[model samples]
Target: MGLFIFNSSIGRKLIMSISGLALILFLLFHSIMNIFVIFSPEIYDAICKFLGANWYALIATMGLAFLFVVHIVYAFWLSLQNYIARGKERYAVKKNAPGVDWASQNMLVLGAIVLGFIALHLFNFWYKMQLQELLAKLNGEVLHVEGAALVQELFASPVYCLLYIVWLVALWFHLTHGFWSALHSLGGSNTVWLPRIKVISNIFSTVIVLLFMAIPVYYLIINLLG
Candidate 1:
Protein backbone atom coordinates (compact mmCIF):
# COMPACT_ATOMS: atom_id res chain seq x y z
CA MET A 1 0.00 0.00 0.00
CA GLY A 2 2.80 2.39 0.93
CA LEU A 3 4.68 1.54 -2.23
CA PHE A 4 1.51 2.06 -4.27
CA ILE A 5 1.05 5.50 -2.78
CA PHE A 6 4.67 6.39 -3.38
CA ASN A 7 4.38 5.43 -7.04
CA SER A 8 0.97 6.89 -7.89
CA SER A 9 0.07 10.37 -9.14
CA ILE A 10 -3.19 10.26 -7.23
CA GLY A 11 -1.21 9.56 -4.06
CA ARG A 12 0.85 12.68 -4.62
CA LYS A 13 -2.26 14.75 -5.07
CA LEU A 14 -3.68 13.27 -1.90
CA ILE A 15 -0.59 14.32 0.00
CA MET A 16 -0.92 17.82 -1.39
CA SER A 17 -4.55 17.95 -0.37
CA ILE A 18 -3.88 16.93 3.22
CA SER A 19 -0.95 19.25 3.67
CA GLY A 20 -2.71 22.13 1.95
CA LEU A 21 -5.70 21.79 4.24
CA ALA A 22 -3.49 21.67 7.30
CA LEU A 23 -1.75 24.84 6.17
CA ILE A 24 -5.01 26.61 5.49
CA LEU A 25 -6.25 25.90 8.99
CA PHE A 26 -2.99 27.11 10.40
CA LEU A 27 -3.16 30.27 8.33
CA LEU A 28 -6.69 31.01 9.42
CA PHE A 29 -5.80 30.71 13.08
CA HIS A 30 -2.64 32.69 12.46
CA SER A 31 -4.41 35.53 10.72
CA ILE A 32 -6.91 35.79 13.55
CA MET A 33 -4.14 36.01 16.12
CA ASN A 34 -2.26 38.58 14.08
CA ILE A 35 -5.32 40.75 14.08
CA PHE A 36 -4.74 41.21 17.77
CA VAL A 37 -1.80 43.42 16.83
CA ILE A 38 -4.09 45.87 15.15
CA PHE A 39 -6.09 46.29 18.29
CA SER A 40 -3.43 46.08 21.00
CA PRO A 41 0.21 45.10 20.69
CA GLU A 42 0.31 44.19 24.35
CA ILE A 43 -2.51 41.74 23.92
CA TYR A 44 -0.72 40.24 20.94
CA ASP A 45 2.45 40.00 23.00
CA ALA A 46 0.52 38.29 25.77
CA ILE A 47 -0.75 35.70 23.34
CA CYS A 48 2.79 35.18 22.11
CA LYS A 49 3.98 34.70 25.67
CA PHE A 50 1.26 32.17 26.25
CA LEU A 51 2.36 30.14 23.25
CA GLY A 52 6.01 30.70 24.11
CA ALA A 53 8.43 27.74 24.26
CA ASN A 54 5.87 25.42 25.76
CA TRP A 55 5.99 21.75 24.92
CA TYR A 56 2.65 21.82 23.11
CA ALA A 57 3.62 24.77 20.96
CA LEU A 58 6.95 23.09 20.22
CA ILE A 59 5.17 19.93 19.11
CA ALA A 60 2.81 21.91 16.93
CA THR A 61 5.76 23.70 15.37
CA MET A 62 7.47 20.39 14.60
CA GLY A 63 4.31 19.03 13.01
CA LEU A 64 3.91 22.13 10.85
CA ALA A 65 7.53 21.87 9.72
CA PHE A 66 7.03 18.22 8.75
CA LEU A 67 3.89 19.05 6.78
CA PHE A 68 5.75 21.82 4.96
CA VAL A 69 8.64 19.51 4.05
CA VAL A 70 6.39 16.74 2.76
CA HIS A 71 4.25 19.17 0.80
CA ILE A 72 7.19 20.89 -0.87
CA VAL A 73 9.06 17.66 -1.66
CA TYR A 74 6.06 15.97 -3.22
CA ALA A 75 5.23 19.09 -5.20
CA PHE A 76 8.65 19.01 -6.86
CA TRP A 77 8.57 15.25 -7.22
CA LEU A 78 5.19 15.32 -8.91
CA SER A 79 6.25 18.11 -11.23
CA LEU A 80 9.31 16.13 -12.27
CA GLN A 81 7.22 13.03 -12.81
CA ASN A 82 4.75 14.91 -14.98
CA TYR A 83 7.46 16.61 -16.97
CA ILE A 84 9.26 13.32 -17.55
CA ALA A 85 6.03 11.67 -18.65
CA ARG A 86 5.45 14.44 -21.16
CA GLY A 87 9.07 14.92 -22.23
CA LYS A 88 9.56 17.62 -24.90
CA GLU A 89 5.97 16.98 -25.95
CA ARG A 90 4.80 19.08 -22.99
CA TYR A 91 5.62 22.24 -24.93
CA ALA A 92 3.66 20.82 -27.84
CA VAL A 93 0.42 20.99 -25.87
CA LYS A 94 -0.25 24.71 -26.07
CA LYS A 95 -3.96 25.32 -25.59
CA ASN A 96 -5.57 23.73 -22.54
CA ALA A 97 -8.66 23.76 -20.38
CA PRO A 98 -8.94 25.98 -17.33
CA GLY A 99 -9.89 25.09 -13.75
CA VAL A 100 -7.37 22.63 -12.29
CA ASP A 101 -4.99 22.82 -15.23
CA TRP A 102 -3.28 26.13 -14.51
CA ALA A 103 -2.83 25.62 -10.78
CA SER A 104 -1.69 22.03 -11.17
CA GLN A 105 0.78 23.08 -13.83
CA ASN A 106 2.39 25.82 -11.74
CA MET A 107 1.97 24.52 -8.16
CA LEU A 108 5.60 23.39 -7.96
CA VAL A 109 6.99 26.80 -8.83
CA LEU A 110 4.57 28.53 -6.48
CA GLY A 111 5.40 26.11 -3.68
CA ALA A 112 9.13 26.80 -4.06
CA ILE A 113 8.72 30.56 -3.87
CA VAL A 114 6.41 30.24 -0.88
CA LEU A 115 8.74 27.84 0.91
CA GLY A 116 11.74 30.10 0.30
CA PHE A 117 10.01 33.10 1.81
CA ILE A 118 8.70 31.02 4.72
CA ALA A 119 12.27 30.38 5.86
CA LEU A 120 12.88 34.11 5.99
CA HIS A 121 9.62 34.56 7.84
CA LEU A 122 10.55 32.01 10.49
CA PHE A 123 13.94 33.59 11.00
CA ASN A 124 12.35 36.97 11.52
CA PHE A 125 9.51 35.92 13.83
CA TRP A 126 9.78 32.30 15.03
CA TYR A 127 13.46 32.48 15.84
CA LYS A 128 12.93 35.56 17.92
CA MET A 129 9.96 34.30 19.87
CA GLN A 130 10.58 30.55 20.29
CA LEU A 131 14.31 30.20 19.99
CA GLN A 132 14.89 33.28 22.08
CA GLU A 133 12.62 31.86 24.75
CA LEU A 134 14.58 28.62 24.79
CA LEU A 135 17.87 30.47 25.07
CA ALA A 136 16.57 32.68 27.85
CA LYS A 137 15.37 29.67 29.79
CA LEU A 138 18.77 28.07 29.43
CA ASN A 139 20.75 31.18 30.34
CA GLY A 140 18.65 32.43 33.27
CA GLU A 141 17.60 35.64 31.56
CA VAL A 142 14.35 37.10 30.31
CA LEU A 143 12.94 36.18 26.89
CA HIS A 144 12.98 39.88 26.08
CA VAL A 145 10.39 42.22 24.65
CA GLU A 146 8.26 39.66 22.74
CA GLY A 147 6.88 39.40 19.18
CA ALA A 148 5.37 42.90 19.16
CA ALA A 149 8.66 44.68 19.72
CA LEU A 150 10.38 42.58 17.11
CA VAL A 151 7.60 43.35 14.66
CA GLN A 152 7.83 47.04 15.36
CA GLU A 153 11.61 46.94 14.96
CA LEU A 154 11.39 45.20 11.61
CA PHE A 155 8.65 47.48 10.36
CA ALA A 156 10.58 50.51 11.45
CA SER A 157 12.84 49.88 8.53
CA PRO A 158 11.20 51.01 5.31
CA VAL A 159 13.30 48.52 3.36
CA TYR A 160 12.20 45.54 5.46
CA CYS A 161 8.61 46.76 5.34
CA LEU A 162 8.72 46.83 1.54
CA LEU A 163 10.30 43.40 1.48
CA TYR A 164 7.57 42.06 3.76
CA ILE A 165 4.94 43.56 1.47
CA VAL A 166 6.55 41.78 -1.49
CA TRP A 167 6.59 38.49 0.39
CA LEU A 168 2.92 38.96 1.32
CA VAL A 169 2.13 39.50 -2.35
CA ALA A 170 3.61 36.10 -3.13
CA LEU A 171 1.66 34.63 -0.23
CA TRP A 172 -1.53 36.16 -1.62
CA PHE A 173 -1.08 34.44 -4.96
CA HIS A 174 -0.24 31.14 -3.30
CA LEU A 175 -3.22 31.17 -0.96
CA THR A 176 -5.67 32.29 -3.62
CA HIS A 177 -5.06 29.11 -5.59
CA GLY A 178 -4.30 26.81 -2.69
CA PHE A 179 -7.33 27.56 -0.50
CA TRP A 180 -10.17 25.92 -2.41
CA SER A 181 -8.04 23.64 -4.57
CA ALA A 182 -7.22 21.72 -1.43
CA LEU A 183 -10.90 21.23 -0.81
CA HIS A 184 -11.52 20.27 -4.43
CA SER A 185 -8.78 17.68 -4.15
CA LEU A 186 -10.61 16.24 -1.18
CA GLY A 187 -13.69 15.74 -3.42
CA GLY A 188 -15.54 19.00 -2.92
CA SER A 189 -15.44 19.84 -6.60
CA ASN A 190 -18.71 18.97 -8.22
CA THR A 191 -20.70 20.62 -10.99
CA VAL A 192 -22.69 22.52 -8.40
CA TRP A 193 -19.97 23.27 -5.84
CA LEU A 194 -16.72 23.96 -7.67
CA PRO A 195 -17.59 27.44 -8.86
CA ARG A 196 -18.91 28.47 -5.48
CA ILE A 197 -15.84 27.05 -3.74
CA LYS A 198 -13.58 28.94 -6.12
CA VAL A 199 -15.28 32.23 -5.33
CA ILE A 200 -15.20 31.67 -1.59
CA SER A 201 -11.59 30.55 -1.76
CA ASN A 202 -10.50 33.68 -3.59
CA ILE A 203 -12.38 35.91 -1.20
CA PHE A 204 -11.04 34.17 1.90
CA SER A 205 -7.51 34.26 0.56
CA THR A 206 -7.71 37.95 -0.25
CA VAL A 207 -9.11 38.89 3.13
CA ILE A 208 -6.48 36.90 5.02
CA VAL A 209 -3.66 38.27 2.89
CA LEU A 210 -4.87 41.83 3.26
CA LEU A 211 -5.18 41.46 7.03
CA PHE A 212 -1.60 40.25 7.30
CA MET A 213 -0.24 42.70 4.76
CA ALA A 214 -1.95 45.60 6.52
CA ILE A 215 0.16 45.29 9.67
CA PRO A 216 3.44 46.31 8.09
CA VAL A 217 1.81 48.82 5.84
CA TYR A 218 0.07 50.42 8.78
CA TYR A 219 3.28 50.72 10.74
CA LEU A 220 5.22 51.96 7.75
CA ILE A 221 2.69 54.56 6.85
CA ILE A 222 2.29 55.76 10.40
CA ASN A 223 6.03 56.03 10.82
CA LEU A 224 6.64 57.81 7.52
CA LEU A 225 3.65 60.09 7.44
CA GLY A 226 3.65 60.99 11.10
Candidate 2:
Protein backbone atom coordinates (compact mmCIF):
# COMPACT_ATOMS: atom_id res chain seq x y z
CA MET A 1 0.00 0.00 0.00
CA GLY A 2 2.76 2.42 0.89
CA LEU A 3 4.66 1.45 -2.21
CA PHE A 4 1.57 2.01 -4.33
CA ILE A 5 1.12 5.47 -2.94
CA PHE A 6 4.74 6.26 -3.77
CA ASN A 7 4.30 4.97 -7.33
CA SER A 8 0.71 5.47 -8.48
CA SER A 9 -0.46 8.82 -9.89
CA ILE A 10 -3.68 9.09 -7.89
CA GLY A 11 -2.01 7.76 -4.77
CA ARG A 12 0.85 10.24 -5.14
CA LYS A 13 -1.65 13.04 -5.50
CA LEU A 14 -3.46 11.84 -2.37
CA ILE A 15 -0.22 11.98 -0.46
CA MET A 16 0.22 15.54 -1.64
CA SER A 17 -3.33 16.36 -0.51
CA ILE A 18 -2.93 14.89 2.96
CA SER A 19 0.46 16.48 3.59
CA GLY A 20 -0.65 19.78 2.09
CA LEU A 21 -3.62 19.83 4.47
CA ALA A 22 -1.34 19.15 7.44
CA LEU A 23 1.04 21.95 6.44
CA ILE A 24 -1.87 24.33 5.92
CA LEU A 25 -3.16 23.65 9.44
CA PHE A 26 0.32 24.22 10.83
CA LEU A 27 0.59 27.51 8.92
CA LEU A 28 -2.72 28.71 10.38
CA PHE A 29 -1.54 27.95 13.91
CA HIS A 30 1.90 29.43 13.24
CA SER A 31 0.44 32.66 11.84
CA ILE A 32 -1.68 33.02 14.97
CA MET A 33 1.39 32.53 17.11
CA ASN A 34 3.30 35.14 15.07
CA ILE A 35 0.46 37.60 15.63
CA PHE A 36 1.18 37.35 19.33
CA VAL A 37 4.74 38.55 18.68
CA ILE A 38 3.32 41.85 17.44
CA PHE A 39 0.64 42.14 20.11
CA SER A 40 2.64 41.07 23.20
CA PRO A 41 6.27 40.04 23.06
CA GLU A 42 6.22 38.72 26.62
CA ILE A 43 3.23 36.55 25.92
CA TYR A 44 4.77 35.38 22.66
CA ASP A 45 8.02 34.45 24.38
CA ALA A 46 6.05 32.54 27.01
CA ILE A 47 4.25 30.68 24.24
CA CYS A 48 7.58 29.91 22.61
CA LYS A 49 8.98 28.55 25.84
CA PHE A 50 5.94 26.36 26.20
CA LEU A 51 6.62 24.95 22.74
CA GLY A 52 10.36 24.62 23.35
CA ALA A 53 12.32 21.47 22.67
CA ASN A 54 9.98 19.19 24.54
CA TRP A 55 8.91 15.66 23.61
CA TYR A 56 5.66 16.72 21.97
CA ALA A 57 7.33 19.56 20.14
CA LEU A 58 10.06 17.28 18.88
CA ILE A 59 7.49 14.84 17.58
CA ALA A 60 5.57 17.58 15.84
CA THR A 61 8.77 18.94 14.32
CA MET A 62 9.71 15.55 12.96
CA GLY A 63 6.23 15.06 11.54
CA LEU A 64 6.37 18.47 9.87
CA ALA A 65 9.78 17.72 8.34
CA PHE A 66 8.58 14.36 7.06
CA LEU A 67 5.51 15.91 5.52
CA PHE A 68 7.52 18.62 3.83
CA VAL A 69 9.95 16.19 2.27
CA VAL A 70 7.26 13.78 1.11
CA HIS A 71 4.99 16.48 -0.21
CA ILE A 72 7.74 18.18 -2.23
CA VAL A 73 9.30 15.00 -3.55
CA TYR A 74 5.93 13.72 -4.66
CA ALA A 75 5.09 17.03 -6.25
CA PHE A 76 8.21 16.81 -8.39
CA TRP A 77 7.53 13.17 -9.19
CA LEU A 78 3.97 13.95 -10.24
CA SER A 79 5.16 16.82 -12.38
CA LEU A 80 7.73 14.63 -14.03
CA GLN A 81 5.06 12.00 -14.72
CA ASN A 82 2.81 14.66 -16.16
CA TYR A 83 5.52 15.94 -18.45
CA ILE A 84 6.31 12.42 -19.54
CA ALA A 85 2.67 11.67 -20.20
CA ARG A 86 2.24 14.82 -22.22
CA GLY A 87 5.47 14.09 -24.15
CA LYS A 88 6.60 16.60 -26.78
CA GLU A 89 3.17 18.20 -26.69
CA ARG A 90 4.35 20.05 -23.57
CA TYR A 91 6.52 22.26 -25.76
CA ALA A 92 3.52 23.11 -27.89
CA VAL A 93 1.89 24.75 -24.85
CA LYS A 94 2.63 28.46 -24.79
CA LYS A 95 4.91 29.75 -22.07
CA ASN A 96 3.47 32.56 -19.94
CA ALA A 97 0.34 32.89 -22.04
CA PRO A 98 -2.49 35.20 -20.96
CA GLY A 99 -5.21 34.30 -18.41
CA VAL A 100 -2.85 32.24 -16.27
CA ASP A 101 -1.42 33.51 -13.03
CA TRP A 102 2.30 32.82 -13.49
CA ALA A 103 2.19 31.25 -10.07
CA SER A 104 -0.42 28.62 -11.00
CA GLN A 105 1.65 27.41 -13.95
CA ASN A 106 4.95 27.53 -12.05
CA MET A 107 3.97 26.09 -8.69
CA LEU A 108 7.11 23.96 -8.56
CA VAL A 109 9.26 27.02 -9.11
CA LEU A 110 7.41 28.93 -6.40
CA GLY A 111 7.69 25.93 -4.11
CA ALA A 112 11.44 25.88 -4.65
CA ILE A 113 11.64 29.55 -3.76
CA VAL A 114 9.55 28.90 -0.67
CA LEU A 115 11.78 25.99 0.32
CA GLY A 116 14.86 28.19 0.03
CA PHE A 117 13.26 30.69 2.39
CA ILE A 118 12.33 27.91 4.81
CA ALA A 119 15.96 26.84 5.06
CA LEU A 120 17.02 30.41 5.78
CA HIS A 121 14.19 30.73 8.31
CA LEU A 122 15.09 27.52 10.14
CA PHE A 123 18.69 28.61 10.40
CA ASN A 124 17.67 32.06 11.61
CA PHE A 125 15.09 30.89 14.18
CA TRP A 126 14.73 27.15 14.71
CA TYR A 127 18.42 26.38 15.03
CA LYS A 128 18.82 29.26 17.43
CA MET A 129 16.06 27.96 19.67
CA GLN A 130 16.02 24.15 19.48
CA LEU A 131 19.60 23.38 18.56
CA GLN A 132 20.75 25.92 21.09
CA GLU A 133 18.82 24.03 23.72
CA LEU A 134 20.49 20.77 22.76
CA LEU A 135 23.96 22.31 22.72
CA ALA A 136 23.34 24.09 26.00
CA LYS A 137 22.57 20.80 27.70
CA LEU A 138 25.66 19.20 26.21
CA ASN A 139 28.13 22.03 27.00
CA GLY A 140 26.48 23.51 30.11
CA GLU A 141 25.33 26.84 28.68
CA VAL A 142 22.12 28.85 28.38
CA LEU A 143 20.13 29.97 25.36
CA HIS A 144 19.70 33.70 26.05
CA VAL A 145 17.92 34.99 23.01
CA GLU A 146 14.32 33.82 23.07
CA GLY A 147 11.55 34.39 20.49
CA ALA A 148 10.98 38.12 20.86
CA ALA A 149 14.66 39.03 20.77
CA LEU A 150 15.12 36.87 17.67
CA VAL A 151 12.18 38.50 15.92
CA GLN A 152 13.43 41.99 16.71
CA GLU A 153 16.93 41.23 15.52
CA LEU A 154 15.80 39.72 12.24
CA PHE A 155 13.19 42.31 11.37
CA ALA A 156 15.53 45.16 12.32
CA SER A 157 17.18 44.61 9.01
CA PRO A 158 15.24 46.07 6.10
CA VAL A 159 16.66 43.64 3.54
CA TYR A 160 15.69 40.48 5.43
CA CYS A 161 12.26 41.91 6.19
CA LEU A 162 11.67 42.69 2.51
CA LEU A 163 12.77 39.18 1.55
CA TYR A 164 10.39 37.69 4.11
CA ILE A 165 7.49 39.71 2.70
CA VAL A 166 8.28 38.46 -0.79
CA TRP A 167 8.34 34.89 0.48
CA LEU A 168 5.00 35.41 2.18
CA VAL A 169 3.49 36.71 -1.05
CA ALA A 170 4.65 33.59 -2.86
CA LEU A 171 3.18 31.49 -0.06
CA TRP A 172 -0.17 33.26 -0.46
CA PHE A 173 -0.41 32.31 -4.10
CA HIS A 174 0.75 28.76 -3.46
CA LEU A 175 -1.79 28.14 -0.71
CA THR A 176 -4.71 29.70 -2.56
CA HIS A 177 -4.44 27.15 -5.35
CA GLY A 178 -3.23 24.16 -3.36
CA PHE A 179 -5.85 24.36 -0.61
CA TRP A 180 -8.87 23.91 -2.89
CA SER A 181 -7.09 21.45 -5.13
CA ALA A 182 -6.24 19.29 -2.13
CA LEU A 183 -9.90 19.12 -1.13
CA HIS A 184 -10.95 18.27 -4.64
CA SER A 185 -8.27 15.57 -4.81
CA LEU A 186 -9.57 14.17 -1.54
CA GLY A 187 -13.07 13.59 -2.97
CA GLY A 188 -14.68 16.67 -1.44
CA SER A 189 -15.85 17.74 -4.89
CA ASN A 190 -19.46 16.81 -5.45
CA THR A 191 -22.48 18.68 -6.77
CA VAL A 192 -22.77 20.74 -3.58
CA TRP A 193 -19.40 20.73 -1.76
CA LEU A 194 -17.22 21.70 -4.71
CA PRO A 195 -18.02 25.40 -4.94
CA ARG A 196 -18.29 25.72 -1.17
CA ILE A 197 -14.85 24.22 -0.57
CA LYS A 198 -13.30 26.43 -3.25
CA VAL A 199 -14.64 29.57 -1.58
CA ILE A 200 -13.61 28.40 1.87
CA SER A 201 -10.15 27.53 0.62
CA ASN A 202 -9.57 30.99 -0.85
CA ILE A 203 -10.81 32.76 2.30
CA PHE A 204 -8.77 30.56 4.63
CA SER A 205 -5.61 30.82 2.57
CA THR A 206 -5.91 34.59 2.23
CA VAL A 207 -6.47 35.09 5.94
CA ILE A 208 -3.53 32.94 6.98
CA VAL A 209 -1.10 34.51 4.50
CA LEU A 210 -2.21 38.04 5.33
CA LEU A 211 -1.68 37.43 9.03
CA PHE A 212 1.84 36.19 8.38
CA MET A 213 2.67 39.02 6.00
CA ALA A 214 1.41 41.53 8.57
CA ILE A 215 4.13 40.63 11.07
CA PRO A 216 7.01 41.56 8.76
CA VAL A 217 5.18 44.62 7.49
CA TYR A 218 4.55 45.84 11.02
CA TYR A 219 8.15 45.47 12.07
CA LEU A 220 9.48 46.99 8.86
CA ILE A 221 7.33 50.07 9.36
CA ILE A 222 8.46 50.47 12.96
CA ASN A 223 12.14 50.02 12.13
CA LEU A 224 12.00 52.38 9.17
CA LEU A 225 10.37 55.13 11.23
CA GLY A 226 12.93 54.87 14.00
Maximum-TM-score candidate: 2
Q: What C-alpha lDDT, on a 0 to 100 scale, does residue 16 get in candidate 1?
A: 88
TM-score of 1: 0.90
Estimate, for each residue in 1-226, the C-alpha lDDT of model 1 and write its tens digit: 8875587777777888899889888888888899888789999999898888777988998999998888888877877887788776546457776545455466667677777878888899988788989788888876744788888888899888888788777777787788787888778789999889989988998888888888889989989997
What TM-score would each prediction reach against the true structure? 0.90, 0.92
Q: Per-residue CA lDDT of candidate 2, range 49-87, in tens?
A: 877766787798899999999989888988888878877
lDDT of each: 0.82, 0.86
lDDT of 1: 0.82
Instruction: Tell me the lDDT of model 2 at 42.
Output: 94
Query: For model 2, where is the 10-residue window of minimal lDDT?
Result: 88-97
- All predictions: root-mean-square deviation over Cα? 2.1, 2.1
Clashes of each: 0, 0
